[model samples]
Target: MLLDLLKLHLCEACSMTELHEAVALGDYDLVAEILRTGRCDPNHKDVDWHDRTPLHWAAAKGRSELVKLLVDHGAQHCLRSDVGWTPAHFAAESGRLGVLRTLHSLHAAMDAADLFGDTPKRLAEIYGHQDCSRFLETAEVESRSYRRTAAMKGIPLDQRDEDWEVKKEELERNPPYSRENHTSSAQKKKGKKRGKQ
Candidate 1:
């Protein structure tokens, strides 16, 4: 396995990490082997892919076993991408109900919102993933409940990404214009043109 990995590394000029490649390819055995080696950080973000971790890939691919393996190996469930999307968001978008269930069972953050204030539930709704949306509706409530309980019990929760918080705060301080604003302005111009005609 090591020889195969070494040969792949020597041959491929891709910048993505071996772990990322394995997860992206949905190679369960290869992923397990990589995790066992303990040489790679499971939480290492692929900058080329908008700072997405291996866990995000597993969730997006709906690999329940891979998701379990990654989390068990100390992958941070709260890690977000460049756009502040958690693994839950990807799973919801792709209608990965089993992946969502697996993540919830593992105590991963299910109610986290992205930079655009879209929760996993919202993404499920937008993507017409009824099953995922329904599951997320209850999961969101349960997630909040346990999070509050953990806080009161003084149990540390790995639900917040500190770096993302800083970036979020910065964005809030100097917020950019929303796409809605652009669309509204275009609509108003069209209305005025129609009235003139």
Candidate 2:
């Protein structure tokens, strides 16, 4: 029974990436060690958690230090989850002002909107994070200014997640549930009911 239990534990452990686990557990030392050894990709998304990366977890957990570590290790802060929620979104939702500040300092896209067209600032407002919302009000303007300056200077910014964009495009093209689809299905149901009557 002990051997079986050990095997089960090992399998469960193997299912979650060490980097994600370390970040989630808030084990700074273990996370640092894992990054140093390059044991896992910092940007690896957790499929079981709506495609959230370690950075997302760190931001949500209000771990500004971990956010820095992940970004330094080449984590893309622009990466979005299944719903297009970036690390900034998570931080804003959880009122992690420090994480937002950390992300802004690193030139993350704080003004990025999710699939629902809600930016981090909007999320902060929605979640009643007045402090975060106030900060983001200025941050969003600065973010846009920085982008424009970079464009004028011909400085390339690594802010876009091309893979996510492509996936988003695919979802838009073949959405499982859209307004038109829902309306058509509703009409079909009504027609069936009328025929029965």
Candidate 3:
């Protein structure tokens, strides 16, 4: 069975080693081939310290093609390594503008914080990537103001007002799931039980 063969031949650990080698040698075609087969998990980290993903290696080496391939295959852009660095952070720190652009186009969250609460935007500025820093600023602004419902209205970009409402009837028609509400109810129940005690 192909699945069985893949399981037997595709060592997650070995894939990391191969990924490092491919990045070091800049064998993007070979990297793509390996990734296409679905044998290598692009999100896998090295066994040693740092535990960097394939995206990390490709970004650090400025291997834009390899980085794109890994991202297209569902490599997590938001994953933080042991050193608290994401692929975008690495790209910015290494001055890999191409990799940074690819990541941004994919909607990789520019403001995603790592363990130290440092976002890629901060890293870009700190690393002196003026273009990347500017892109991150624009991305953050767009995210804060743009709405999918408003986008459906086909309003002119220059004329759209912040006060435009989606309609209360429409909002009432589709009440979104509230996990917070559920958690609050659970907390209330716990509080009542504690009071009874």
lDDT of 3 by residue, 1-197 (tens): 78946753665746366766676578988888767776567777675736677878887778778877887787776665653566777777667778877776665655555444566677777656798788778765554355343467874322221211232234346545453444322234346767998
- lDDT of every model, 2 decimals: 0.84, 0.85, 0.64
The CA root-mean-square deviation of candidate 1, after full C-alpha superposition on the true structure, stands at 7.3
> Which one is best on lDDT?
2
Better of 2 and 3 by TM-score: 2
Give lDDT tens digits, candidate 1, residues 94-162: 899999999999888899878777888988887678999999999999999999999999999889888
Model 1 spans > 4 angstroms off: 1-15, 176-197
User: Which model is ahead, 1 or 3, in terms of lDDT?
Assistant: 1
Write the residue-wise lDDT of candidate 2 on 1-197 in tens digits: 67655644553454358888889999999999878866677887777888889999999999999999999998999899887989999999889999999999999888998765779998787767999999999999999999999999999886888878988898888887874444432234346777999
Candidate 2 positional error at 168, Å: 0.9
lDDT of predicted model 2: 0.85
Query: How well does candidate 1 score on lDDT at residue 155?
Result: 95
What CA RMSD would you report for each candidate?
Answer: 7.3, 9.5, 14.0
Any idea what lDDT model 3 has? 0.64
